[model samples]
Target: MCHIASGWLYGGICRSKLRRHYSLPEAPCSDSLIHCCCRACALTQEYTELKIRGVDPSIGWKANVEKWNREGLEPPIVAPGMAR
Candidate 1:
């Protein structure tokens, strides 16, 4: 149940990233439809896209952000601060 519910969000996010990476004006189909039809393929494509773009998705997002910061690139999103 949790997987099904979260699928919608991840599917849309993957599709959005693909569109942004390719500067696409519109997608060939909706994210949910594509994911529903072949989720593995969609995930593979997203993973490949990340690998080709030099992001190691095996590493967590915060680590990736720290890496980008070390490289002198501003992170796309800011990390939240921890309160004591």
Candidate 2:
């Protein structure tokens, strides 16, 4: 049940990026099916890709946010009326 939901979410995310950023016409349907059977491998690939792109996932979100603040990086924008 979790795999089904997660696969759908990630597949939508990957497909959106592939089409908009990479100019890809189609993402394979088999990718979602594969994710159902092999979620760990799918997430491993995602982690590896993030690492290759110079982002460290191990430090996690809150720590990374603090680090970015200390480094004087721009904070992410919040939508109007949204709490920080």
Candidate 3:
């Protein structure tokens, strides 16, 4: 992505057709973007909320479900033995 951006910013130094029509500005320094800090704070808040809810934010639910199924655990029987 950075290479593509650089090519577009510098007028296609590498003869990339994709960089021809688009003009991009030089990338900003990290200090120039307030949104970077906001993203970090939002990520921290999400983890805190997950901890409060007693869920491991690191483990995805789909992966957990797949692991459980691999271990021969059936999905929850909603009606307690009703036929499918």
Candidate 4:
């Protein structure tokens, strides 16, 4: 179920964040289309983006929040449906 949600639902969000964080210009196409066309590349890009931002995607969300709190940094703001 988690895998399904991540692939089907969260893929676009990940790409959006990568684009926004790097200040990349809008793509000529939508993220879903990109993901559909090149899933491996899209997922790799997303993983690399998270690593570049110092977020370990392997760790669960709660651990990430705890890490942020311990470091005296606030976690990134959550979108409505993304709250865990």
Candidate 5:
């Protein structure tokens, strides 16, 4: 998703296109443009968010769903649906 968004920022580095038609500036695009510049930090932020929410991203989504069902807990896979 971040990669898709970088185009408007004229970003093509990191998770972006890696191709060029116009010159890209050597500055940050937007406050949320982490993936186009700092991928590690972006990943860390996601990991931290999951940890803070008590959701282990290392576990596959399906496994989490199964575990939630077994434990009678609500699953964390609700956002991807709700975002739509």
Candidate 6:
């Protein structure tokens, strides 16, 4: 599992409002915690590009995971599992 900015999945605030958003089982924010199984799909390109650059893959993964944990960017349940 991974975490990403909600806007990346839902587009910006305008798009968020345009769609009929719904909540998840353990959503942290009632208004903005729209569940998106496609969230990881949204990050594939960026992750791959970083990998192609020979960067430490864990760096990007950890940064996004940390951000989501700190900001409650998505539902608590949607956040990445504990680091192995």
Judged by TM-score, which candidate is best? 1
Writing each residue's lDDT as its tens digit, candidate 1 over 1-84 gives 988668866887778776665554445787767787888887887788667666788996679979998999864432233346
Task: For each candidate, give its TM-score against the true structure.
Answer: 0.62, 0.46, 0.32, 0.60, 0.51, 0.26
Query: Where does candidate 4 stray beyond 4 Å?
Result: 1-10, 17-24, 74-84
Q: Write the per-residue lDDT of candidate 5 for residues 1-84, one digit (tens) a residue.
A: 986765535432432331111222334454237655676675675567566555777896578778888999984432321222
lDDT (10s digit) by residue, model 6, range 11-45: 42433442232221222432233334344542453
Note each model's CA RMSD in angstroms: 10.1, 9.4, 16.8, 8.0, 11.6, 15.6
Rank by TM-score, highest first: 1, 4, 5, 2, 3, 6
Off by over 4 Å in 1: 2-9, 21-26, 73-84
Q: Measured by TM-score, how close is model 3 to the native structure?
A: 0.32
Q: List the residue pairs that clash in candidate 3.
A: none
Instruction: Give the per-residue Cα lDDT of candidate 1 at 27.
Output: 56
Error of 3 at 46 (Å): 0.6
* Superposition TM-score, candidate 4 onto the true structure: 0.60
Better lDDT candidate (1, 6): 1
RMSD (Cα, Å) of candidate 6? 15.6
By summed lDDT, the worst window of 10 consecutive residues in model 3 runs over 15-24
- In candidate 6, stretches whose alpha carbon ends up further than 4 angstroms from where it belongs are 1-37, 60-84
Rate residue 22 of model 2 by lDDT: 28
Q: Top lDDT: which candidate number?
A: 4
lDDT of each: 0.71, 0.58, 0.42, 0.72, 0.52, 0.42
lDDT of 2 at 4: 58
Candidate 3 segments whose C-alpha is farther than 4 A from its true place: 1-37, 63-84
In model 3, how large is the Cα lDDT of residue 33?
38
Q: Which runs in model 2 stand beyond 4 Å of their true positions? A: 1-26, 73-84
